[model samples]
Target: MDLIQRFLFEDLDVRGALVQLGPVWRQIQRNRDYPPAVRSLLGEMAAVTAIIAGNLKTPGRITFQLSGHGAVSLLVIDCSETLNLRGFAKSEGPIVGNSISELLGDGRLLLSLDVEGMQQPYQSYVPLEGETIAAVFEHYLQQSEQAPAALFLAADGDNAAGLFLQKLPAADEKDADGWRRVHGLAQTVTPGELLSLDASVLLQRLFHEETLRVFEPKPVRHDYPPDREKISATLRALGREEIESLLADHGEVVVSDDLSNHEYRFSADEARALFDTPPPNLH
Candidate 1:
């Protein structure tokens, strides 16, 4: 089972989270058949998304999107506050380069948080400034949160994992050098260890001397249920003429939700029924 665990330094003003994904990661790629380079990049993003989603204080969803003009044109991952995830990647053609910059040439990262009761989702943009996804997120945390952070991420055919460490605003008073010491210890972790070791064992190995408080692990899963009402509303907005044209060309109007890996198909009779009543005023 995929899970995420939160931990804190008992004496120092720092917090951290660890996420390990196995079945969920495999499920995400089961239908996509992404290239090896693209798969690895998406897996890393999946891990990062889980960690961020797990920290949400309210009921909502978070989306991470990477877009550019390279071989891999777009990568998107959506994770709900409950850690339910669904994502997909789009490529222009064959992928060549392995680095983030090469795979996503001139790409920018966009993070959107849609919290409950908010009129609009809060969003932020981060430059693809690092070679690895971990580094990119670390830079984002530093810039957006105004706090130093250490992030390590890794993924393979079987699993994906991440380790995060951040300095609290009041960390300087609790332990003048706490953030430095903890960050240094975290740097010693290897990708192999992060992927294979249990959260307890890994934490002990990295910070054996620090007093730590570990929380219960929370489950994460890949769940994208069909939103029929939303899809119907979308077709209604497309207007009767467009829907009729689509049905005429293909004998049916088929709309695909890539993220959910599901399709909505409306036949001639069904499509006509949608317009039996006047469509809502989109304006």
Candidate 2:
């Protein structure tokens, strides 16, 4: 497993995190052909979400999903507390987007926080500025919420990386000398640096003089939703009528086959989840 580390400053009491994705980058590419602009956005989103997961406290998944009208219809970054991330994008052919506002037009971004143990999830929708993801996030902090957050992200073919900084409420507002100094230092982080440096090295390079405390690394893992058995049970839940209708309409949905059986069927897992009782656990 590749390393991702989180650190903090003892004297400054400021928290920081670092994450690098090389192998995971390939997994994302397996789904479809994504244009350069779309790929870059997803890359940045993945990196930022990883950092966000590291900083926030949660056992479940946090999703940064963007959907709107434009060349790029959708972009999703699903990140868990452990750092297992996988996602895909929907776009309209080859489209070059310089900013979120230009790409999404009149658009909005949805930040969904889903916990497996919880019944109700948390979500916030911030209007898209047609600017870069970085700019949109800045607006999200100032408008949607009160916390002032900054994000710097970059991506290459094999790796995606980001640095996120948010100022916490300090006891002394005007007297807080470290705040401005830290922010200025953070501003020195270039896109190339974010994509290149590892966590420890990056922090040391950025804040060499500050007293920093490094935290124990959290193991990151991934989960693939819904297995084949679950898929069949879900297909059966369409009351058989709908399933038959679909079969008639679209013929067989072939997943795979052996020498003897065709093993093809319609998929209705999503519909089942929305309408019918879930199948018994096969575990």
Cα lDDT computed for each candidate against the true fold: 0.88, 0.68
Candidate 1 wrongly placed segments (more than 4 Å) = 57-59, 228-233, 266-283
What shift in Å separates residue 145 of candidate 2 from its native position after superposition? 5.8
lDDT of 2 by residue, 159-180 (tens): 8876666656561353367666
- lDDT for each residue of candidate 1 in 195-271, tens digit (9 for 90 to 100): 89998999999999999999999999987777876788888889999998898889988888988777888888988
Those runs of model 2 whose alpha carbons end farther than 4 Å from true positions after fitting are 1-3, 142-145, 171-175, 254-283
Q: Give per-model TM-scores.
A: 0.88, 0.80
Pairs that collide in candidate 1 are none
Worst 10 residues of 1 by lDDT: 274-283
TM-score of 1: 0.88
Cα lDDT for residue 102, model 2? Answer: 62
